[model samples]
Target: MDNNCLFCRIVAGEIPATVVHETDTTLAFRDIDPKAPVHVLVIPKEHHADVVTLAQNDPAGSADLLAACAVVAETEGLLMEGFRLLFNTGAYAGQEVFHVHAHVLGGEPLGPMLAPR
Candidate 1:
């Protein structure tokens, strides 16, 4: 775990978070800033700078992260209605936190994945 990473701190119990689901390799928590009615962040316990890093270095953990997202969606009652999973890789993509995580969003129409250019 990266000592300076916020998500790592949350996973290590150093920081407080509203955790919704947890497993041996993953954690699902409510977003502090909710973008949707059912917005949650799913992350791997191990540190990875971004999705690409996680996918290349720890594929199993990456899979666990995705699995956790699905579980979070189901638990948050957004499964059947569907949900969007998003990973922001860098500043241009709006990734404030360096630690890799997926945002599970639903509970209402999400409109579009991107705005008009």
Candidate 2:
């Protein structure tokens, strides 16, 4: 784990986060800044720079993260209405943290996936 990475610190219990769900390989927590009523961040326990990297290096880990998404959606009561799973891969995608995370957004009408440009 990168000692300086924020999510890594959270995984290590060095930084505090409002955790919602956890598995042997993943953790789900509430996003501090919520875009939707139910905004949760799902991450792998093991550090990976991005989802692309995680998929390349650890397929099982990637699967675990995907599995956590369904759990998060169900727990957050977003399954009935549906939800969005987003991964900001790099800076251009507005990825503030280097650690890979899937943003599970729902709990209300979220509108279009992207702003009209």
User: Model 1 TM-score?
Assistant: 0.96
lDDT of 2 at 53: 99
Best by lDDT: 2
Every candidate's CA RMSD:
0.8, 0.8
lDDT of 2 at 18: 97
Lowest lDDT 10-residue stretch of candidate 2:
107-116
Q: For each candidate, what TM-score against the reference?
A: 0.96, 0.97
Q: Estimate, for each residue in 11-44, the C-alpha lDDT of model 1 and write its tens digit.
A: 9999999999999998888999999998899998
Per-residue lDDT, model 1, residue 44, is 89
Provide backbone clash counts, one per model. 0, 0
**Candidate 1 Cα errors over 4 Å, as ranges:** none
lDDT of 1 at 32: 95
